[model samples]
Target: MIRIRLGARGLGGVRFAVSPVGAAKDLLRLVGFSPGTLTPQWRTRATDALSRHRLGLLAVVGGGGPLGYAPDFIRPEPPAFLTDINTGLHQIATTPQERIRYELAGAVNGHAWDPGSGHPPPRQLLRALDRGEDHFAHRLADEMARFWHAALAPSWPVIRARLEADVTARASEIARSGLAEALNRLAPNLEWRDGELLVHMRTDSIHQLTLDADAVILTPSVFVDWALFCAGEPPGAPAPRTPLIVYPAAQADCLPPAQDHPLIGAMRRKLLAELSQPRSTTELAQRLYLSPATASYHLQILHRAGLVTRTRRSRHVLYQRLGGAT
Candidate 1:
């Protein structure tokens, strides 16, 4: 059995066990918050209200409802709108995603409720809160943009007024939260220490480790161990006992393909060579002396051409070439 422990440095001695799922649960527990099941009915209620308010697109993609807690782990593929909003928020906020989480209590939801003790400085708190509210407003703007682009493309009036009202209300809620020192500690906290498992958490997912029972537990942070596990490979080749099945062939007409620019053609050739084994866009880009984004964009084009395929292995997307597709 794997054993893990965590320590709180200040505000008196406090400790918690590190579970297999990692630190998100412990962090939430410290704040007296527990995860709840996100049921379809609750989703329907929120979606319905959102639709009525013309915020349906944002709500659906953003994921709201009774099970809105972190561990509920229901984040859909964030719509491009949400992604762009999150990117902008990250650029603007000091803490980014951690500052805006809300919870239900005292008949009304409270912003930045901390069951865990300790207060930050009043100025920092205010800044964090302001950043949080700004992040939320940007998210709302993205939703409005999408809604306007699709449902009301020809008109400016439908989304403009609603966008104004939503932003106003969101901003007003930020004002009501009070810029007090204690009120601002509601953001999730992260700590790393020696001899304690450090589990790096992203979004709602736990980073996992695949250490052998006899292997040394060198790192206290689960995240460190998780990284080690990812870096290690399993022993031995595939068993000969494994079966392979050949599928019936389908006919296709041979046609001349559109020509690619010289740069694009060279990039595609490099990608095909690199994809003989799965490799992340970043790694491939580094090897090819290309920027990560440029590599990724070209990889997508290669993917469309059936020269490559991508699978998400952990946080990285790994690309592989189809053996005979080209």
Candidate 2:
């Protein structure tokens, strides 16, 4: 029972992000490191890859950290938008030695094993951390980058679509009902009451705290399934500037709405071809000689099919083809 009391700054400061690093980390945990369960295809892919090559440092901290504590330094602070995995890996690679020492300490400690797991904590990289080696951080980042490309990249578009769809829906809810209302309904284990966000913990740990960060990062994960996870600089732990909460993504509902819309018309086909680069509907409309309404209608169909992804840039929402994988 962790009570995250949100002040006006915290409530008004809430933001949502689609984190590739987060999903990738959760996938690693779900498949082999933890009691988590990934969807069949994801489990098979991740498991096969893990069996083939040893991730060394990544496998050490893949579940984030030790004692069910995921370190904050590994994943860069998400900025309410989607970015490629390299952007995040760079952040991890350049993490300061002091920060890494503070955060990674708990992960490498001998007492950090999961309770029911038959195996001990992964501690092969501890000697490097203990020796105050800056290269250890880069090595960790390198392993994560390799693991993500090998195991997660193939299906990232599918996962990205699911994450963005959830964020889009939740953002809409925040717009309509206000952030307070949205928080109350974010997950089964969470509720924003009065000025506090109550997290019903699966563990017996109980505490009262304040949500006193610049922004609350809400990322949705397909691998997390029905679980709601909250992490921050808890109690006396190394302080993280922003608190993070991961909710279950709406995977089942992410795709196929455009199936009913269908990709039949010549207009849609042409519009899809034009979206190879990001373009606002107005730009697309003017280029194609179609009305903005006609352009938007077709673009919406393509977006729902997961073939294109839309992002708000300045005053306009730009759409780009997500790759031909769909």
Candidate 3:
């Protein structure tokens, strides 16, 4: 269990920010050989993409199979609000060499290997670390750049949209409820109580963190299923002992529909036909004699495909067919 003790000031200091660098790092885990217990469809997509690319760093980064660890330096705490991959990469590139080496050494020395499995860092990486090669840091950064370009950059638009939507929903929740409720809603494993946030982790050990003046930055990540915490620091400085928590983004009820899938296309067409007049998911479900869950699922797909547009009428969200979609 991880417990964070926040004072009155600390609790008030909580804020949310999006982290593209953190999300990209999480993608490495998602697309790795053993991405833990993801939804079947997402897992299949990530695995297929990794197989197609065959990145060399796969072994080094994914050595632990599904539970592998990437070196922490790749996603050092963002010095500022991260807007894009370039900003994130620039923060990483500008990190002092000593800090990079220190983190690498910690990753090497602190890594726990499974029985019969080699260490997480590849031999070539280890050699560079041991020899203190100045070029190793640059090479590692380059590898991350390549990985981003090849695997993540193309899909960033859809990914960013989903992330932004989640953030918007979360902000709404906070406005309607409170910070504690918002935190708990992010994941089932989290509980916010009197002056303390409790995190139920898979580990047996217990840990505690106290936030004094520095606010706890809550970052939303799509790839991580469980909550993770890392220390934050000002840009260009070493990380402090205390870290902010990164929790999994709340899952939308419906997965985004694949653009070219025949079934999805057919569903969108059906939804479009029914949506000539604006209809809520509940109304459409009742009219079609389908479960609300199923109706909402297909409706969201249609909405995302540009075949439908949604409008808010007081509390109800209504959808209608868009122009040019028969």
Clash tally, candidates in order: 8, 0, 3
- Candidate 3 on 227-265: residue-level lDDT in tens? 765553334545443356677776632233234323456
lDDT for model 1, please.
0.34
lDDT of 1 at 245: 9
Candidate 3 RMSD to the correct structure? 7.1
The candidate scoring highest on lDDT is 2
RMSD for all candidates, in order, please: 23.3, 5.8, 7.1
For model 3, the local distance difference test gives 0.62
TM-score of 1: 0.21
Q: Which residue pairs collide in model 3, if any?
A: 34-66, 230-243, 231-243
Ranking the candidates on lDDT from highest down gives 2, 3, 1
Model 3 stretches astray by more than 4 angstroms: 36-54, 62-68, 79-82, 111-121, 130-134, 206-213, 232-237, 252-326
lDDT of 2 by residue, 1-326 (tens): 66666777777777788888877777766554464345455566676666566776666666644445556676677755786788888878877766676665545442245444455555576665665546877887887777787777765775677677778888898889987788767777878887777777665353345544555778787666444444566545544557777777764322222212345367777786787899999999999999999899988887785668899988989999766433
List TM-score per model, in order: 0.21, 0.73, 0.68
User: Candidate 2: lDDT of 112?
Assistant: 45
After TM-score superposition, the amount by which residue 46's alpha carbon in candidate 1 deviates from its true location, in angstroms, is: 59
Off by over 4 Å in 2: 33-36, 64-67, 108-111, 114-123, 130-133, 206-211, 227-231, 234-239, 252-302, 309-321, 324-326
